[model samples]
Target: MATQAHRTKPALGEREMIVLMALLMSLQAFGIDAMLPALGQIAGEMGADGNDRQFVIGAYFLGAGAGALFPGAFADRYGRRPVLAVSLIAYIALSIACALATDYTMLLAFRLIQGFACAGLSVVPAAIVRDHVGGDRMARLMSLIMMIFLLVPILAPAVGQGILYLAGWRAIFGMMAVMGVLVGVWAWLRLPESLTEENRQDINLFPILRNMGTALTNRGAIGYVVGSALVFGSLFGFLNSSQQLIAETFDQGENFYLIFGGAVVGMVAANFTNSRIVERFGARRVGHAALLALIAISFAQLWSASQPQQPLYQFIILMSLSMASLGFIGANFSSIAMQPFYHIAGSASSAQTALRMSTGAVLGALIGSLYDGSAKPLAVSMLSCALVALAFVLFSERGKLFGRKVPSPD
Candidate 1:
């Protein structure tokens, strides 16, 4: 490890890199959010019911999570830009495949593979950021990226709904393909390789396994990764069930995107605020406070769900507040998790990201599958995940909460 990463800097400034990473990473969010409005229709047309419809979301996550394990090692061997190009290309092709699928099973299959391709987007960007900066500076950059990245959730469902109205849901995949191509072209042209020659690892299986094992067992980083996964499970569970909750349960089919976007608006604000304050306050302190806030909000959500009459406004407010807390938690958690890895950022990022995605996806699918015309399952699962996350944070801190430790990378 070396602190001289500044000497091997890419041509792009911090702002440019942040914007590029946000869009690149937002591809995955766009894939999920833009399809939310069309889930019911897709289900109806495909003649599926219950948990099967949810697999459209779950299967993609499953693939992405499983697939996330390798891209970073590959990026470590080759370079960030080329491996990311492969991911984007796979994404474009699979979006088309998903669009052309004749049945529900076929669609899920394509989405799963598309998710596999998107893993590159998830790992490479974070590795790239670590390539340039470390510690709280890295956390601020990640928070800024997240602030822009979250806009996809706010706008994508609306875009999906519009496509559902104008040309049909298949065109939404077409939109994804076009966006993929555009982003791919932009990245190909402008995004420089951040992995320097000296840090590049050979394509050896033993070291890959060893590095991945280290990533998994690093006590300092493991808790934040796993805890973040649990918190994200709450978000994923919401994604899995939100369409039905909006369209059928609440009788607000037309307002699904508006309501959902409103819920996410707070998160965007939180990310911006975190980006500004994380450096001064420290990632651990800020993230620890947010994790505690999530617990309190989850309790409120649980109470609302337990009532015979679960008010939609209460749900929306709680959703907003909970997600806002996540805005503070996610990036800082990720930055802290990647802090220990310098040269092996790609492998560490890949392993931890895989764990986060796999754990979150499995837990989310379970939560969503329990949907029974009410929000109790979601509320209970959310509180459970939040509490588990807090427990993991406690374990990571070894009973010292809100403590900031910036371990030297080199």
Candidate 2:
């Protein structure tokens, strides 16, 4: 094996490429988040129980986690484009399956498949970026990608809400199907294969597994990925319970979507700030600082919720601040975790993504189970996850989260 020299040149223009990649990658997160307001309606329509309805969300993420593992190997062997194209095609079909389902079991099964299909779109873009840029430049590109990706959370809930008002829960799936088809066509036409034949490895499960094992063993990689996963799982917990929290606890009634949109605005603002600062400060520095902020906010929110006379406005404020920190943590954590294994970037990306989603699914389910018509479960979960993340960062970087040399792209 040969070591490649680090190169700083960007493969594509920043704005357009970032927007396209972000939009493609965000489909997975948006699919779950946007549907929050409609989860109850879907449950009723499908005759699902409370816990089973939550499974609809859980199963999708579980599928995404499982699906991510294989695509890295496939992308390494064949190329990103083919795997991506196939994934989008599967996304469209699964979305249609979701739309056509008449029972809870069918919807749950389709959602699982849809989650799996989304993995290619979600994971390949990051690997493609790693192919072109490394270190701070990589962090900047990721920040840009995340800045664009933030729009999905900003807009998707409103979009889903509008569809729900016009045609009900099933129409949300129809819209997803349309979005998938359009993105698929666009990808087929505009996106060139980033992984060239020269860079492609032979197809083999053993090698891929070996690479995944290597990634899992790397201390820095495991720390960043696991730390990030806890943070992501906290976010997942919020998504799982946001609708209920707003409607039941806050009594937001028909305005729950607007409240959700407000939280997304906080996220977008953070991403924009990250895009500007991540290059100068480095991903670890910015991410670790942001994680500390998250921990503080989480604890404050938990404390506030414990009060006897907590106001809805106060709850909203805390939720907004907590979500704002996510913008900083999400992209930077991913970039840092992917820093060490350029030789097996594809597999490393796969393992990291899998860990993030799998852990998120478990945490989300646990939080969902703890939902009690109040914000306590969400706040507690967030605080606990944030503390865990802080500990992981300390261990991963050996208490040196900042002032480290940024690795250049090879």
Question: CA lDDT, every prediction?
Answer: 0.90, 0.80
Judge candidate 1 at residue 79 and give its lDDT. 82
Best by TM-score: 1
What are the per-residue Cα lDDT tens digits for candidate 2 across 8-28?
Answer: 443346566677788788777
Superposed Cα deviation of residue 240, candidate 2 (Å):
0.6
lDDT of 1 at 143: 93
On a 0 to 100 scale, what is the lDDT of residue 108 in model 2? 87
Error of 2 at 237 (Å): 0.6
How high is the lDDT of residue 338 in model 1? 91
Model 2 bad stretches (over 4 Å): 1-12
Models 1 onward score TM values of 0.97, 0.95
Question: Top lDDT: which candidate number?
Answer: 1
RMSD list, candidates in order? 2.8, 3.5
Model 1 is weakest, by summed lDDT over 10 consecutive residues, at 1-10
Model 2: how large is the Cα RMSD against the reference?
Answer: 3.5
